[model samples]
Target chain A: EAGVTQFPSHSVIEKGQTVTLRCDPISGHDNLYWYRRVMGKEIKFLLHFVKESKQDESGMPNNRFLAERTGGTYSTLKVQPAELEDSGVYFCASSLTGRHSYEQYFGPGTRLTVT
Target chain B: AQSVTQPDIHITVSEGASLELRCNYSYGATPYLFWYVQSPGQGLQLLLKYFSGDTLVQGIKGFEAEFKRSQSSFNLRKPSVHWSDAAEYFCAVGLAYSGGGADGLTFGKGTHLIIQP
Candidate 1:
């Protein structure tokens, strides 16, 4: 089975511009997740989707960030009016189940650089 | 608040040597502990997890971890280190879901391992 794949391995945009990162999860996976790691910071969760429904989005840092999963097949994270602090690596992950014990497969991650 | 701490920022070990990466977590209840590895420019890969039962848990890529409730620690260990094992390792604590669900994890800053030839 193919693993999770992300688009635009690296993205560079000016501050205040908008950027969207896409993720295609493994086939038949029900759970999709988003996480990010800022420079010199730990990787932190952003949001989760369970079959097109936002299972949990508490990890979202601000209102400018939005994530959507359509048809539960793919997920997109859009950041509008991106700020300089938003520069970091964004990761997408998926799991067969939303249970606590299952392992989550991750993508290569999209490096976003907002200047 | 739940948090994870990886004491060593980086470690250097020789091939065929035993390796240990220390991890400490602070949570109110028993948490799901995990060990993940990430190569350069790659995503985090799950190595092992400890939910319940035996404290020792085996993972892919010849890795294992031991969970100590008393010390509030879950440490990753490998019997023999290989050159390919050089990567960034992170220790995370899964947030307990009240309704039998899963929540986002709290991860440590990560430790970079260097292999000595």
Candidate 2:
């Protein structure tokens, strides 16, 4: 069983540019989550997906950020008009849906640098 | 809302020495606690978790954490530090929803562990 996997381990873009980060969860996992960690700051939750539907998105930072899980297979986080403050590591995690949902497995985060 | 605090920003321990990293949390009910480690160029890895029953939980890579309800703390410990143990350790609290699926986690700033040779 492969752990969660993310695309484009590192991304560098200018402010106001759009960037999309992708995550492929483990096979048969129904729960997916997104989290971000700015430099010297704690990792903060962004949103969560149960299959193709959004479970919770209260943690989303701003309107410019959007997350989607299509076909209940993978997830994508898009940051439009990215700002300098958006430079950080974005992590995606996944787990089962039942009693073991708390046990989340993370992916190698995508380090985004917005200059 | 739940929150986590790691008092130590960084810690240095000699190889083979004992290690302890402090973590404090604030939540209403019995919190779900977790400890995760992130090595250089690696993703966050779950070390251990405490939901109920046992206060002391053992995890991978010879790591263990004790959950103390009185102190509102869950501290990670290792009997002997290894060079490979040098990494960033994060203490987190998972919000349990009554509905079903797991919610997002609240994480601490993380403690950077330095292993001296």
Q: Can you give the DockQ of every candidate in the order shown?
A: 0.63, 0.87
Q: TM-score of the candidate numbered 2?
A: 0.98
Which regions of candidate 1 are displaced past 4 Å?
A: A98-101, B96-99
Model number 2 iRMSD: 0.7
Give the Cα error of residue B96 in candidate 1, in Å.
4.2
Number of the predicted model whose DockQ against the real structure is largest: 2
CA displacement after TM-score superposition, residue B1 of candidate 2 (Å): 2.2
Model 2 spans > 4 angstroms off? none
Flag clash pairs in model 2: none
Q: How many Å off is the CA of A106 in candidate 2? A: 0.3
Q: Write down the TM-score for model 1.
A: 0.96
Q: When only chain A is evaluated, what TM-score does every model earn?
A: 0.96, 0.98
lDDT of each: 0.90, 0.94
Q: Write the per-residue lDDT of candidate 1 for residues A1-115, one digit (tens) a residue.
A: 7899999899999999999999999999887889999988999999888889998899999999999998889999999989999999999988766463256778999999999
Candidate 2: tens digits of C-alpha lDDT, residues B1-117: 778999999999999999999999998887789999999999999999998998999999999999999999999999999999999999999977665757999999999999999
List the lowest-lDDT window of 10 residues for candidate 2 chain A: A95-104
